[model samples]
Target: MEKFKTKIAIVSSLTAVMILAGTASAYAAVPAASKGQATEISAGAKADKKTASPEEQVYNLVTKLQPGEMIAYYIPDKKINLTDRILFSGKGYVLTDYDAYTAKAAQMNAPSLEIPETYPKDYKFKSGVLYLKEPDESSELYKKLDKQLRAEAAKGGKEFYTIPVEDGTGEASGAALTFVKGSVEISLYASHVKPPKPMEGTPVPFSNPDEKTETMVIGGIKCTYTTAPKLKSRLSWTDTSGSVNYSIFADNAKADVLRFAKAIIEPEAK
Candidate 1:
C-alpha cells in the first residue's frame, strides 16, 4: 500500500507537470486575447463555420486543451480549496484540485497599466491577486450561488473568494469572475491598486532545479516567478495501510499561492 501510494503521488505529479507544460506552450502560442476585444467572433465564426454561444466558444477552446490541461476563466480574491460541483454547460463536473492557470490567464490578458508601487501591493498573504477591469459582471449561475458564498465567507479562516463581478467592456455586456480552489475554501479579492511584491526574507514554499523558474515581462514590466513540486499532506488520507501525498505549489506571480499550496497537499482523483 505504501508503494502504491508513492507510485500514485509520482504519477500524479508527473501528470500535473505535463499538463502545466502543455498549457504554458499553448498559451505562449496564442497569447490571451485582450479583454472585451470582441472575442474575435467573426474569425471564430468563420473558423468554426457556425454560430455558437459564448459558452460554446469557450468549450471549444477547452476541448483544445490536452488531457490534464484545464483552463481557468476566473480569478479568486484569496487562496482557497474548492471541492464543489463545477457546473460546466449545465453538467456537474468536480474540480478535484485548483490550479493557478486562471490567475496566469488574468495576468496575461490584463492590459499593461502603470505599476502604482514598486512592491506588489495587492499581494495576499494567502493567494495571488487577479485584476479585472470593472464592468464585466452578470452571471445567472453566480447569482444562484451568491448567498451560499456569503455564508462560506462568514465561516472562513482562509477560504474561497470571488472577483467582483464587472463588465469587462465599458459597454457592460460581459462579466468578470475569479475562482480559487484547493483543499480549503476559496476567496475573491478585487482592487484597483497594483499587486504587492514578495517580501525580502519571505520563504518561498516551492523550488526546483530541473524545473527552472522564469520571469515574465508584461507591458514592459518584469515579474519574477518559479514553479516546483512540493509535498502536500493536508489533502492526504490514511487507511489501515498507510498514507498518500500530493504535489502542488506556487508556479508564477499571477498564481494563487494559497490554491497552489492546497493543490500540492490535496489528493488526486483516482
Candidate 2:
C-alpha cells in the first residue's frame, strides 16, 4: 500500500524504459526515428519509420511520450480506419469516453499519439499499446496516491520521473540506472516497493535469489543486489531494506555493476 509512492522511472528500460529515453522517440515511435521520410505506409495511414521495421516503429511512437501527455494508442492491425484523437476533462489531461474514428473515439484534440496501418494485424505486426489505464482522477484513493508520488520524486535531487502506467505508489527511496551487456534498466526507487501493477499482464513477485545478499552503494544508498545462479535472467542489484535514502538496481556483470555503482555515488548524492 505504501511502496507505490515512487512518482517516476528512469528513462532506460529497454523494452520499457527505452521508450522514455527520448521524448520524440516515446510519443512518436514511428516517424520519430526516421525524421524526414514519413510517407504513409499506406493510403491515409499513420507515419512509419524509414529506417526500422514496423514493430520497432510502433515501439518508438508509444514509448516516446512524456509524463503528462495522455492518449490511447493502437495499431491499425484489425481495422483500416482508426481513431487518432480524443476529448479530455482538462484535469490532469484525463481521457474521457469520446474518441475520434468511424469507431467514434473522439479525443479532446490534444495532440493525439495515434498510429495506423493497413491490415496491420493481418500480418506479423499483431500487437498494440493501449493508454486508457490511468487511475481515476475523480477517485479519492488515486488523488492521495498522486500526491504521495509527486512528493517522493522531489526527493531524488535531480529531476526524476513518475509512473507512466497506473500501478505502484510510495515515496521513492532513491533511484538507479543499471546496465547489462546488451540492455539497460533504470529504477527510480531504492526500497522494496512493488511497482504499480500494470492493467495487463500478471505481476511477478520480487525476491532476492541470494541466501546471503550483497550491497553496492549507489545513489547515496547501499543497495543490496544478488543473482539467481540458475535463473540468469534473475541477476539484479536492488535494496529491499528501507535503511538508506536511495539506491540502484544493477543487473550487470559484477565487476561492471560495482564499478558503475561507485561512479554514480557522489553525483546522485549531490
Candidate 3:
C-alpha cells in the first residue's frame, strides 16, 4: 500500500497543475517576501529566457525542484494584474479573513457549502483557500504546462498520465477551511461537484491499510471515520440529500471529531 501510494504521489506531482485565480482585493495584503516577485527559471530548465505566463513560470519552478528544496508564496488583498510581469505565488489563493474567505467561496458558487456553527472551543478559525485543477485545454498555458509535465515524467522514466483538462471557466470547484489551536489543526474541505477521476487508475481510497476505519451514521449522515498510529483522525461523508461532500481532519480526534461533524450536519439537517 505504501508503495502504491508513493507511485500515485509521484505521478500526481508530475501532473497536478494548480492555477489560482480570483480577486486579490478579496483577501488581505500579500506578504512582502512573495509580493510581485518574478519567478526565476533554473539554469537546468529548457524554458525560454524570456517573459512567461504565471502558469508557465510556476511550472518551471516546480519541475526544477529537488527533493528537499522548496518555495512558497502568499496572496495579498488587491486586484491581481495577471498581464503585469510578476511571479504568481503558490497554487492557492489563501484568505486570512473569514468574511473574505466565505465571500470567495460564494464567488466560486459553492452555495451548497455549509459551515458548522460551533466546534471545539479552543480552536480558532485560521484561514481558507480555494483549490484549482489544471488550466483548461483551450488555454495556451495548458499546452506549455502539459509539455513540461510530460518532459519531467520522461526524465524520470515514468508513464505520463494525461488528465483531461476540463474547462473550469475560471471558477474554483473546491475550497478548504482551516482551524487551529496551538499545535493542533483541523481542515474541512467542500465541493459541490463530484471530483473527477484519475485518467488511468482507480481513485485512491482515503483509508490506509494500517489505519482503523469505522463506518457509522451520525446526525442522519453516514460517515467514515479513520485513525492510524501518530496520524491525524479523519472523518468524511457525502450528504447525498444536500448534494454536498465534506471531510474533516485533526489530531487524535474521535468523539470531538464526531461532535464536530454532527455540528455541521445538524445545521444542514434542520
Candidate 4:
C-alpha cells in the first residue's frame, strides 16, 4: 500500500489534471471564428471587464442550465489564451489540445449542466462540435457558427465529438455521476513534458510501479493503453497524436476505470 501512496504522488505531480471526457487535449482548441460568421453566442452576456472574462462567458452559457436546456459543445474560444473556456456536454467530458491552456482555476465555479438524453428539435452533432437550432435572441456568434455547422451536418459528416449525459440520478459502486463542473476527471494530456522516468532495475519501492504499453478495446474502440500504475494512484497515457493520460484515484479502479472509459468512448461509437 505504501507503493500505492507513492503512485498517487507521482501521478499527482502532473498539473492541470482533468476529465474527458479525458485529458486537457481533448478539451483544447476552441472553435475558430469563421470570418463571415455574423453572430456572437455570448450576446446575452454582458461584455464588461468582469463579465467579459472567458470564465464568465463560459459560465453564462450554463448558469442554472438544466438538462435538455443547453446543448454542449467542444468549441474552444480561440480569442483568449490565458485560460481556454470549453463547453462540456453531459457526459461532462472536456478536452484540450496539447498546447492549449484551460481556465481550470477560473472555471472552478461553473454551474452544473447536463447533456440532454435526446437532442432538441433540429439539433445535431458534427465533427465533435454540437450544432443546435439557434434559440431566439441567441448569441450571433453561435448563430453564425451553428448555421455553417448545421449545413455541414446536413452533409452527413460527424466525429466522436458529442455524447449524451444522464441525470446524475443513478449511483454506481465503481462509477458515479459527476456534476462538479470544471473538475478534471482524466486530462488527456498532450503536453510536451512528462513524468520522470523511474530508474531501471531498482524496484520503485514507493508505488511498486507496473508500467506497460498495450492496446485496450474499450467500448469497441481499439486503442493502445499505457499504464503508469503506482500503488495508490495510476496514470496511463496512450496514443501519440492526441495522447491520453488518465488520473485514477481509487482503492479499486478496475470497475470505475473501465466504466468511465466506456462512458466516454461508447458515445462516439455511433
Judged by lDDT relative to the true structure, which candidate is superior, 3 or 4? 3
lDDT by residue for model 1 (26-61), tens: 432233444322123221453657654334444344
What's the candidate order when arranged by decreasing lDDT? 3, 4, 2, 1
On the 0 to 100 scale, the lDDT of residue 136 in model 3 is: 46
Q: By TM-score, highest first, what's the ranking?
A: 3, 2, 4, 1
* Candidate 2 residue spans exceeding 4 A from truth: 1-15, 22-26, 29-67, 70-212, 215-222, 229-252, 263-270
Model 2 poorest ten-residue lDDT run:
84-93
Where is the poorest 10-residue window by lDDT in model 1? 86-95
What is the RMSD, in Å, between candidate 3 and the native fold over all Cα?
11.6
Clash number by candidate, in order: 38, 36, 5, 36
Tell me the tens digit of each residue's lDDT in model 4 across 26-95. Answer: 2233334444332244523354543344333433333323312223332333342212221332222232
Output the better candidate (2/4) by TM-score.
2
Q: Each model's C-alpha lDDT?
A: 0.29, 0.31, 0.51, 0.31
Better of 2 and 3 by lDDT: 3
TM-score of each: 0.19, 0.29, 0.56, 0.25
lDDT (Cα, 0-100) at 117 in candidate 2: 25
Worst lDDT run of 10 residues, candidate 4, spans 125-134
lDDT (0-100) at residue 174 of candidate 3? 59
